[model samples]
Target: MQVEVISSVNEACSGKLQHRTAIVVDVLRATTTIATALAAGASCVIPAETVQDAKQLTKEGDLAGGDRFCRQISGFSYGNSPGQYRGKQIEGKRIILTTSNGTRALCKAMRADHIIAASLLNAEACAQLAWELRRDVVILCAGSRDSFALEDGLCAGLLVHCLRQHDRSGMLQVDDFGSAMEALYRNKANVIMETLAQSQTGKKLLRLGQREDIVSCSQINVLQAVPYLNGGSLIQRLPGTIAQTAAPLC
Candidate 1:
């Protein structure tokens, strides 16, 4: 198996991810929120790259969740916070999710053989599912806009660590972004919290009084389901369930 990490969605095109198993990361909030929703029993999540797209999907009969900058858009039912998705009955429903960065990354990876939405919340489950599928994996980080975000990179490193631990025979490849992720994980205790607290996007969240989101997104493996994108919908693959499934289609 081979592992590659791309920093932004713009760098990941259909040709680049063709026939490859892709893992999408947006740990600051979007991916984390999705994992939480699935863990809380959402039937599936349909990622939309734009808010307009999300609204259109809703008009066509999909439940819509609009998240802009950590806040729910006016007239939308939910924001990007994982806390909001909890304890709600979302089973047997389809969520049309649009976020600032994460959903766009999912849209970009739609052409991959296997596309899984991942975050620190479900890092271990994502890695385990990847190993079960036994395909070369590409970890794509949805950086803040077109630039890097420490939170997403750190989550990518955690996924790398999980994959390396479970499948030692596989080859691991780190890109510039992946190397930065490894470095960030190495010094997480000292720099991550403070750096995030001061980051441009992070500060905006702070001003919005969502400091708890930062804390929640940083925890590793709080969710047990690996949210995989299949046929334009996101499905959760519980641990010990993939082995019974068919071989990866790609």
Candidate 2:
């Protein structure tokens, strides 16, 4: 298995993701929010690239969510907070989500054979699924403001580390950037929360009074549910579920 890591959403190219498993990481919020929503029993999360698209996608019962400049869009139901998605109100509801960077990364990875939404919360599960897919991997980090965010890079590194662990045959080949991320993850493994709290996006969230989001997004491997793109929506696939049986659990 070959693993390559893109530094940020801006660095992702559809050509590079073709026929590969693309894991999108936005640990500070976006991907983490998706995973939390799915785990909390939301039907599906439809990622939109723009606020207009998100609004257009929403139906009567659908919830609109997103963030702009690190703040929730005025008319949206929620912002880019994992804790907000975990609410009981979101149960069995469809969410039209648009984030500053995360959803854009997902859109960029649409050309891949499999698109997996991942974060530090579910890195191991995402890595296992990517391994089972039997394809080369591309990890796209949904960095903040078109630049690499340490939190996203840390999640990418964690995924790389998990992938390496899964492929015990020593056949896993990671690109230079992936290797660097893996090193970063290893170095910060013991201080995951602290690392996130100190990241660029993390500090921004703090300034925005979203420290809970940082705390929620920092829990490594606490969630067994993996969120992967199915058509235009993201749904959960549990650890042992076969691909054929993977359906929306909303």
Candidate 3:
């Protein structure tokens, strides 16, 4: 059905997402990092809206990682870089994550019936899963610092475009921002990686000497992981499957 794109957590909070499917986008890093972590075999990711929350969520064998405004938070085990989460070292461990915007957005949309983490890395998989659920979808972008972020919007656009391709019924109702984002994705499809590298968040990371992270996070459709919030954790699932053991929470 219906498709809408929320530019910020504030926008999401002003509306009702309860019982609806939400795909949260933070393409510059957070969502991309989470998907990469899962693909690398991290057991699950627990998003914390604040550093305090992240510290509280950490337990034995759990890794505490996150950033604030693209800088690694003091005492964090790792920053929100997808490259830092590869290989078997992080396997089977829980990640307590806190971010400048993404985790806060996740917390704000916790009431949604379904919440999937989306990045350029897992856009297609997320769209396919949302289509299968047959629920109204909200593409909620974790905009940087309460403002709209280009990378997140572009990823939302990609999700919308993929959803439109899968819907043969011609009933995909897209709101104004959704249409703009879809067009943005289509228009910039040719130089997406380059464009993302030049985005605000991308540039910020670069100034922080994290250019490799930008390149890694900008990779498109390299992961099939679809991480969703369930039972106080974000668990990875296939396009058509879900976490059966998850308990409902909002």
Q: Which candidate should be chosen as best, given lDDT against the real structure? A: 2
* Residue 80 local lDDT, model 1: 86
In candidate 2, which residue ranges exceed 4 Å CA deviation? 243-250
lDDT of 1 by residue, 1-250 (tens): 6778887776777776877789999877889888988887888888988888788777544468857766787777778887777775666667789998899999888878888999878888898888777677889888886887777777788777787788665466656666667667767735655666666667888999989887777676778898988888888887677656656433
What lDDT score goes with residue 85 in model 3? 90
- The digit string of per-residue lDDT tens for model 3 on 132-171 reads 7767889899998888999998999999999999978788
Query: Which parts of model 1 have CA positions greater than 4 angstroms off?
Result: 59-62, 189-195, 243-250
Q: Rank the candidates by lDDT, best first.
A: 2, 3, 1
* lDDT per model vs. reference: 0.79, 0.89, 0.88
lDDT of 2 by residue, 27-111 (tens): 8789999999999899999999999999899999998998986899999878888888877898999999999999999999999
The top-ranked prediction according to TM-score is 2
lDDT of 3 at 193: 76
> Ten residues in a row with the worst lDDT in model 2?
241-250
Q: Best to worst by TM-score, what's the order?
A: 2, 3, 1
Backbone clashes in model 3 = 0
Worst 10 residues of 1 by lDDT: 241-250
